[model samples]
Target: MAKSTSGLSRKRMGEMYRTMLRIRRFEETADDMYMAGKVVGGVHVSIGQEACSAGVCAALREDDAVLTTHRGHGHSIAKGTRLPEMLAELMGKVTGLCRSKGGSMHIADVSKGHYGAHSIVGANMPMAAGIGLAYQLEGKDRVAVVFFGDGASNNGAFHEAMNLCAIWKLPVVFFCENNQYAVSVPAEYSTSVDDISVRSKGYDAPGLTVDGMDVAAVYEASREAVAHARRGLGPSLVEAKTYRFFGHSRGDPHYGMYRTKEEWEGWKGRDPLIVCEKMLKMTAKQKKAHADAVETEIREAIEFAENSPEPEESVALEDIFA
Candidate 1:
């Protein structure tokens, strides 16, 4: 939108816009379902952070592996997960991915190269490195992308995983969706550096931070980082400066006790939905049409999930990782 810095074509721009809308609508619908007590476990939303998910996944291939954080619905959607099955998974239906066993935090569709969504903070980094190593050993050019939050960046796993990937030159992209807050703790108080990407130097890898609200900026950065890893250039850290519109999970307030109303309003102004529409110069009719299409899709997904049967209890323990 700003002088074509990313230089994305109109088609790609529109596709990314659609992706952002799909994630936005999907999360909103899921949150509503959670509130209605129609889902299992808790729902961690990535509503305002759609640009980060959509932009990065847009740069990746369907066969490239992906590991997601708890707040990873958008990541799954961006990585080409079917709406019906993903929603069904959240609904704990037999038709869902993992046959309703994995529910919210553990939805895995390996057929699409999605390993799984790990609930433990920073836990999936090691798994990502392992996958990257597998690709390297097999002489495959595919890369592995792991998504985590700024809070997880401070964990020992962050350093250990990134350092390991860096030293071994593993084909992995350490993607960070720094939403500025980890649950109730603001990043300013917890993190030492203003930009998380700078810490990549500690592991002898390249890194950069981008406007997480701007999909074009994120897309360009992600494309290069993904390409870098695919070329056997080791790991790269990408930090997206973003803010979550909702609380850390379902039942949490928008500006809970810790966040100020002013801070919330400030970030709301840069809502990914608004920013994406503006970037694409979408007309009022076009915007409505896009949102309508997403709504229709989400509505159908909910019906499918609701109508699908739950997994049979007899087979409950059959497909576990044991």
Candidate 2:
């Protein structure tokens, strides 16, 4: 069941709506670019899970850090990553945040404390826990937030990372954006228990559930979790129960295969963008204006990406360590 969010203010609600729009437009462009071969190595689209990214990002401070998965564009956008650089990175251009060496799945903007994203399933969780450990050692309160899917929660790395964070009392928040599928495997078939949150008890961390469709619910939950971590409290886990409108990746045809058309429609009707727009009290005209602005921003970024020069061959091994 989607969580209730009735206390959000008009301004904050408007921001959430805009952020969703930004993600939608940016991803739309990415899809087109992928089809055109501009975005190399392909990408996992986050067309339906905007709320989880935008909401959780809103709750993070500038000093906070995050690690994301292959389906990471939304997370990057939510962290205020510059659209031009992100797009350039996807294009493998020199102007990219990663100097075009890291391409789509490895875009990193450490300036934003994003610490980069990972293509390997369940791998970033351990890295995020390590970041938390470093912060503790340095006597800093920076919290490390790791985003993964329900499928990742079942991996050995997930358990190991959770145990490490727990034993160390690390300031890490393991936020699982469970979109109900792990690349065509429905979550119901993968896990014995229904809710992923319950697994946190094994690590002695507080487990929580939030409305991944409602950006406000995610923001509230993330805010509380981050505050606790910043206070030197131990790690926590948040299972955002959400659904993905698209397939797990650009190639997977999720519609009418694993789920029914009716199920997709039911979730789409409650699109987080629409939810936030309604909460902002914005009429159709106002909503359209904001949406158009976001679209425009994305368009400029795409244009910049298309025009950016690709990385030179000489630098292929620049960042690699033997």
Candidate 3:
């Protein structure tokens, strides 16, 4: 689908494209399944923010821990979480990542350094600090990345964790996906600063805000932040300015409720997948081929989930407590 490029090899660029597309297709299908009652619980799809997760995780190693928010499927997939396990978790199958317990808002695979995801806004913030502290005390070079939204930045944990990580020089990359809204509330209405990354200045940490729609841009910026942390330079805040094509959640209106049609249309023009294709100069045939592969993978995941067994009623409460 791509030819060799100078900055990033054509192969890696193509991989990123496919990853973004994978996220888009996966979320879309998951949402559909949720509505159809095949999938359990509330589904929050990161359809338009694929570039943010794809690019940031591309800059990370498998051993680096990732702590993400409720809308975390994109980040989990980006970290190489298996599609079957993810779907199983969504479907509440025993073969799921968290053994049918965590579901969509809570999935964790420690073997791959994906610590866990939280439904509470900003909940992962302090956990990111704790994980970073653990790595520091252990003298491990591995870093922790906490993916939060613009809403979480306003949470108290954001301030505490950022301050503590900065003061201690902990290895952490604070990745913020500022998608313009926190539920139905506009970020402009709730946030005091125009750019959330600017808040990093208060803690004397390196901060950068990039275009979340451009996978290449997000990757480059994330690589820089990751490098700074690996060098024991402490936490770095990397914010991606992006948008979500879907509503805040299920039953939420896609338009006329909070976002203007013009705003949504403008963002749609720069959809991450479209941007990736344009940048790579992929042919229509190549685009169609990539899409087919993504669809096939997703279908297989669903099939596996449906066929998998559910957790036994006997052991359902066994893993409830730590």
lDDT of 2: 0.86
lDDT of each: 0.89, 0.86, 0.90
Q: Taking the tens digit of each residue's C-alpha lDDT, what string does model 1 give over 162-268?
A: 98999899999999989998998889999999999999999889899989999988899889999999999999999999999998885568885788899999999
Going through the candidates in order, what is the number of backbone clashes in each?
0, 0, 0
| Tens digit of per-residue lDDT, candidate 3, span 126-221 | 999999999999998989999999999999999999999999999999999999999999999999998999999999998888888888889988
Writing each residue's lDDT as its tens digit, candidate 2 over 1-322 gives 4375557677776777788889988888888888887777777788889998888888888888989989899998888889999998888889988888777788778899898889999999999999999999999888989999999998999999999999989999999988888887889999877889889999988888988988888888888888888888878899898888888767767587777888889889988887776666678799779978987898789889889888778788787775
**How far is 73's C-alpha from truth in model 2 (Å)?**
0.5
The number of clashing residue pairs in model 1 is: 0
* Best-matching candidate per lDDT: 3
Query: Any runs in candidate 3 off by more than 4 Å, and if so which?
Result: 1-6
Clashing pairs in 3: none
Error of 1 at 231 (Å): 1.2
Candidate 2 Cα misplacement greater than 4 A, ranges: none
